[model samples]
Target: MLFISAITFGADYDSIGDSTIVRKRSDLTQKLYDTLLSIKGNGIFFGMQHATGYGVGWQNNNDSCDIEKVTGDYPAFAGWGASVTDCNIAQGEGFEDARYKIKLFHDMGGFNTMEWHADNPFGGNCYWERRHDKTKDVVASILPGGEKHQEFLTQLDNIASFFNSLIDDDGKKIPIIFRPWHEHTGAWFWWGKGNCSKEDYISLWQFTVNYLSDEKGVDNLLYAYSPAKNDSREEYLYGYPGDEYIDVLGQDNYYDLRQDATNMPRFVKMLETLVSIANEKNKPAALTETGAFTIDAKATMPEDNWFTEKLLKLIMYNDKTRQISYAMVWRNGSTSHFHVPYPGHPAVPDFIDFYNHPYTIFMSDMEKYRTKNE
Candidate 1:
């Protein structure tokens, strides 16, 4: 219910695109989209997954973030995992922890995005558990008439309850970018390409959106569809639900972007195609999840300035790719599996340069840009 007068839109319509499904979005959700649209081509907001929830040597500390320690400014965007709420076995904290962190980040003038690595509905350990029984299609089993349809609904009910709990001090719902079933192009999760048929994937996406928006009445959200690296745009859109059910166009590329300098062109071209699709659809695009898996001195790489020389160069490679609204790195879980630079890591100097770059927007930069645009 927190409406920004400067970015007001018709209450009954979506201003970003011709998506009727987004017509009933909350005021703050619409305003957030408008803000993203306003600053799309100007600068790319830097983001870190699980920024405030935990870090290299700390966990559950409200006042700690690896990015903040290194750059003196929080990321413009914060990525969170909703898998804990859905599966209770994935990479995020509990519901109350997520609610508190999300509200705190929003109150500090930062954007929030969440992804759900939902557990396999048909009996599995976690989202990564693939079934050996090729006779049954997991996605098919969870569709409208499938055997596990009700179980899927129960999981969605948990998700809706968690999203509904994201309230601010004024008791208004805090809008968030909900990204479920992400990285589907990869074959790691149950919803991956090889595990589910294209029709089933699309159906699952549409069903989730309809259930959350229409049945569950969860309207304070902007849905994002992100797939892992793809060979072509056709491959990327192979399982796309539709324009009406999607608000953001995002792609996750860690293999191409984090590799040597030779692969930088491929990453840039991939982003160009993604941005073109977003432009054609009139929606904001983002590098939803990326980053080197481990950025230590012993890690393999071309140069020491991974943040500036590699990541930043690829992002600034072409005008099309540069139009990305934001680029979010993966989480900083521990010393070996972290993404952002810690206090005395060798990547700190280049990270500072990356943070100081004109095209990179942090929290303070976003606030200033929004104020000026308003």
Candidate 2:
């Protein structure tokens, strides 16, 4: 499959030097285009990060409990986060679970995306609490020939091995969107705005991708570059590692972080910004992470139809915003930290309505997308 340097997003997909990777990426991209493109703009896909195979309901009940266990259905896209704590942790049980879920989603004709919550290489700092003081010099350590550079490579190699291992029943590589160093605009993570220079960040990104694609020979993945919400396109693309290194233009935002529902003007504005940038760049854009972070819709039922009223309305109703390929909510970690609603939860009725909406595509709907594309 011959590919060009510049890709017209909705029309074609770009390559990153690997033939197998190029084919898989192009196939997935075409699938996305077929599913989303419509005469009346496009359809938006509903997603949930770390949803089935693990969730708040599972934490509260049995490990077998999941979105399908409760609601009898799954989201169109499922996300997983791998943490490179010890250099070889990607080969451990946690990562094995993630791989299992990825295969499960693929077998069902749904999509899968993975991101990293990399630990600070210089010290004992974890992803969530990566303060500047704790991991300020970490990025430098991971650059070529830096003190921790070799250690970082070990992590990437293991991660690449995992990506390469995701083969389907027919012995074909399964495609997945791989997002790394997400929420770079936030002040928390070690790789965030204050911790590293744009030069260093771009190098980190390019090096990681090259090591994965060239050195490790992993070709079943598409790279996604996601940052925290920023108002202007300039601010959003400030540290971007250029078009060749990225396949998906995505953003991560939470309702609680923005202090409002999905209909919030600020939220809509950022969505517009992402969509406009994607359209101009001829790339696919997505609301990579979102949802009511802390609200227990079941207990409080605070905002009725938060799904259809706020979120679905914002994505499905708008002409331009509807072009966003997908919108994913964060993980349902616990009863206190859950994002999506469980079965019999107060938001179930509204979520059901959102799932039923023609513009909002979920897991079962993917069969139609596959048949249409076929």
Candidate 3:
């Protein structure tokens, strides 16, 4: 009952009333969804954002430092950003390029999660440049009857088209955890706290889900809402849209590499809050994004086993927090913005141990678990 039987089409989702049709939401997606709902408090999956799509050694090339490329086993989930989906491109890397990556990642036996960095439709302003004074006005414009509503609709059309294009060799649309307007609690993006009112933000989120799922008939998506950092329950769900619109509740945090002591305790307490919320709502929770950025690769990389020593221990140490379905690290754009270490990097040994640990579930492990569950 947690999932529904779905059919996918290579052409368009809404125009699939005739002719041969492939299951758009494959049985594999159902298995993954069912497994996520059932694995609470028992185990957790390891994931990486843009792992194979790009990395330190390679940028959209054959030599990326992806989980499988480095360790020969893919991660449980692969994260991607939908920045360029607005400019008629699927994402930053380009339409065809991103399509190839998504297809390959899903075919390699990994789940997909995508986030968006939507440009300001009102003034055509970018995410980095903000005008808090115009935040409310911008929010109003995106509403159903707002002046800029048509532009917003155009953006969603392109995004829905791209998501529908993520087909496997069998021509099945890959299921995705579509996380739009993420990190809204942070004040960096146009849709952040200061940019829009809580009510308006919630409206935007609900509208997005409705337009995509109902209007466009994009049925292969599970909506996820992720906020940046918050200490208490109220702070975390300050602008929460509602339980109906959200399938997964997630959070993103970054461990400071400069500090000698790790923030595992704080993270544990926060996880406790997340677990409580998820249990109450009867939905899965995930550490959607976490990492140590701007590492001084030359300075011996402090606390080499940060993956096993800190991140993993956070979930293992607490009983309730272990309910998290997955924990994903950020991308390794370059030497400076890297999260996971490479083959020759100092943290490889520790990461290998983390990957081998029984509690950790990589892509292969997920397949094995799915088989057992089935």
Clashing pairs in 2: none
Give TM per candidate. Answer: 0.88, 0.85, 0.84
lDDT of 1 by residue, 1-374 (tens): 43332211222223544432333677667777887777777898889888886788888686689899988889987888766443251332377777777887788877799888776665563354555565768889889999988888887887888787777786778889989888898888888888888889999998898888778878788889999988789988988887777889999987775544356677888899999999988889999988873323223333458888778988888788889998998877777677878888888888899999999989877667555534
- Give every collision pair in model 1: none
Best-performing candidate as measured by lDDT: 1
RMSD of 2: 4.6
Which residue pairs show backbone clashes in model 3? 7-24, 8-23, 8-24
By lDDT, rank the candidates, best first.
1, 3, 2
lDDT of 3 by residue, 200-247 (tens): 998998788778876887867878888987888998997888665677
Model 3 C-alpha lDDT versus the unseen true structure: 0.73
The lDDT values for all models are 0.78, 0.69, 0.73
